[model samples]
Target: MKGRLFAPRLVLLHLVFLAAVVASGWLGWWQWERAHEAGGSFQNLGYALQWPLFGGFALFLWYQVVRMVNGTELHRQGESITVPSATGHSESAGEDATERTTGGARRRSPVPPPAPPVTEEEDPELAEYNRYLAELNAAARSR
Candidate 1:
């Protein structure tokens, strides 16, 4: 525990946590002073109360980080989580489309393939545009 706490990265984190707490406390103090001034409003007082809570929250987050680094954080067990696949099948099912292996990698999503390109014969507007372009080309060649 002590070793983890004194690690270089953790030491940096501890300094950051201290800075955050001290800054928050200083901000709270500034807000409190502003709240007591002649031009002060209730908003300043609200902020004065809120800044200390922010400092406390920072302390809580720092503690959680330390706990996580130390691997002492509690984790829930005996819970089976079911993830849904792109093909509308849950992982709990016997067959998952996402789990279908292709050279050890998962298969792609089951989206339909793109439609083939439309031919001018299949589209009257496209055929009309092509006829107009042909006429313009022939006129240009004559000129």
Candidate 2:
């Protein structure tokens, strides 16, 4: 079983990115508010940029988290994933599709042999249950 905090490397990277974004936003907001008191236009630009920056960071972080949750091979064990700097999105998308298809195709169990039918006398409890079920079904259909 996985530990409570045993997040994969990709997930941890996303968390760290999220933390940096939050910290940067907080710092920017503090500086902006302070500069606004002193009447600086640069702080206005910084403040204006803050939301978009934070939003982009959040989107990237979300992508990483989704990849981790969906079992994308972002990293293996202690090694960092060697994703191509360009077109990484396509690679990840292909991996996601492949994983989903392969996962579904994996068989959980083999077909079992058919069981012999039991007579009413062989299992009184089963007979009673069947009678009760039939009664319930009849009442439902009547309703």
**Which candidate leads the pack in TM-score?**
1
What is the TM-score of each predicted model, taking all chains together?
A: 0.49, 0.35
What are the runs in model 2 whose C-alpha is more than 4 Å off?
1-8, 68-143
29-111, model 2: which lDDT tens digit per residue?
A: 77667667757677576675675577577778677666665543322222223333243452332222222224343221244
TM-score, model 2 to reference: 0.35
In angstroms, the error of model 2 at 39 is: 5.0
Q: Residues 42-110, candidate 1, lDDT per residue (tens digit)?
A: 999999999999999999999889778655312121123366755577764223323444445344347
Q: Which candidate number maximizes lDDT?
A: 1
Model 1 residue 102 CA deviation in Å = 32
Pairs that clash in candidate 1: none
Every model: Cα RMSD to truth: 12.0, 16.1
Go through the candidates in order and give the clash count of each: 0, 0
